[model samples]
Target: MRKLVYLVATTIDGFVSDAADSDPTGTVFDPVGAHAAPLMAEYPEMIPTHIRPMLGLTDTPPKHFDTVLEGRGSYEIGLAGGVTNAYRHLRHLVFSTTMTGVDDPAIELVNTDPAARIRELKAEDGLDIWLCGGGTLAGVLRDEIDELHLKVYPVVLGKGVPLFGIPTQDSRPGLDHFTLRSATPYDSGVSLMIYDRTR
Candidate 1:
């Protein structure tokens, strides 16, 4: 009865990374910050609009997950940016075969089959599991994912890492439920789409 939430940002074309497995041009825009300088002067809700409901911040997540899971690349990105520690919200579990050790004591490193461990995690008690992804991780765990919070942007990456990498015939995952939520316009003409996955 544990829930796995895949929360990510994808281009309008559904590519999570460029062809080289890197973020496309506008995946993370500064709308909430840039626009805030001028817009917030007129409307306070304009800033919160980009967050809160748009990012599923309203409901408190189920108290079944005390850890957050992210691919190695995502964790590296944070590390390179000087975040040597996990965020205040949750314990971090980073999956990386290449990473020998994690500098952050708060983060535990897992180098084996992530999908298998994720399934095993469901049996434990904590807050809901968050699948902070990169294309490689998503493709691998597509079957175990229970919910997908897709933040669709209005722009297109043209050619970047696809949201779902091509899987082998035996591993393709199918969606059982999908719901579209409110969309907010950001810089680069992208709108965020929140999708709840139930399979």
Candidate 2:
């Protein structure tokens, strides 16, 4: 049984991306770049292969996960930027209904049931599963996630894709408590918080 970790970068106010709800990897914020070395050293496997060349990283050994699960919005950001398969290093699975026949053969699409698909993935033997991006899919598979690695930036985006979407009044089945395992702050004002699911 493998663990599912949602490793994401979010604003201090709990927003993941800029307004209009774009992908997290679309642009590298200047502030984030300051703390990039630490994050890259911590989670090298999460770095896209195409980016490693620029970062001067050789994919020798993965840090944590071997698989990555993403939502349509997260995957489409690459497509919108003319990149169909963003994470060439990991086993990428995208949850989408409207997308099909992407150019990449390594990319897998799950349109039927995201939760069910995640459950099946959890049973497989692997390093771990990285819930790379996707607020909606994250909300849907909230129960299956075993850990959370949040990179909290100092900036605040008042309006954007939320870390966890859905109105507070709406009842979500997987609203579980998490125990903070670690909180490390960087000079660039980016704080890395690791949380393990209480259940």
Q: Best lDDT goes to which candidate?
A: 2
Q: What tens digits encode model 2's per-residue C-alpha lDDT throughout 62-168?
A: 77999988888888778887887878888888888888756688988888978788889889888899997867777777888899999888777777777775446
Per-model TM values vs. the true structure: 0.69, 0.90
Worst 10 residues of 1 by lDDT: 41-50
- Candidate 1, residue 163: lDDT: 67
> Which segments of model 2 are wrong by more than 4 Å?
24-34, 168-174
lDDT of each: 0.62, 0.80
Taking all chains together, the TM-score of candidate 1 against the true structure is 0.69
Task: Give Cα distance to truth, residue 194, candidate 2, Å.
Answer: 0.3
Assess candidate 1 and give its lDDT. 0.62
Q: What would the per-residue lDDT of candidate 1 be over residues 28-75, giving only the tens digit for each residue?
A: 433444333432332222122124455444443334345678788766
RMSD (CA, Å), each prediction: 6.8, 2.2
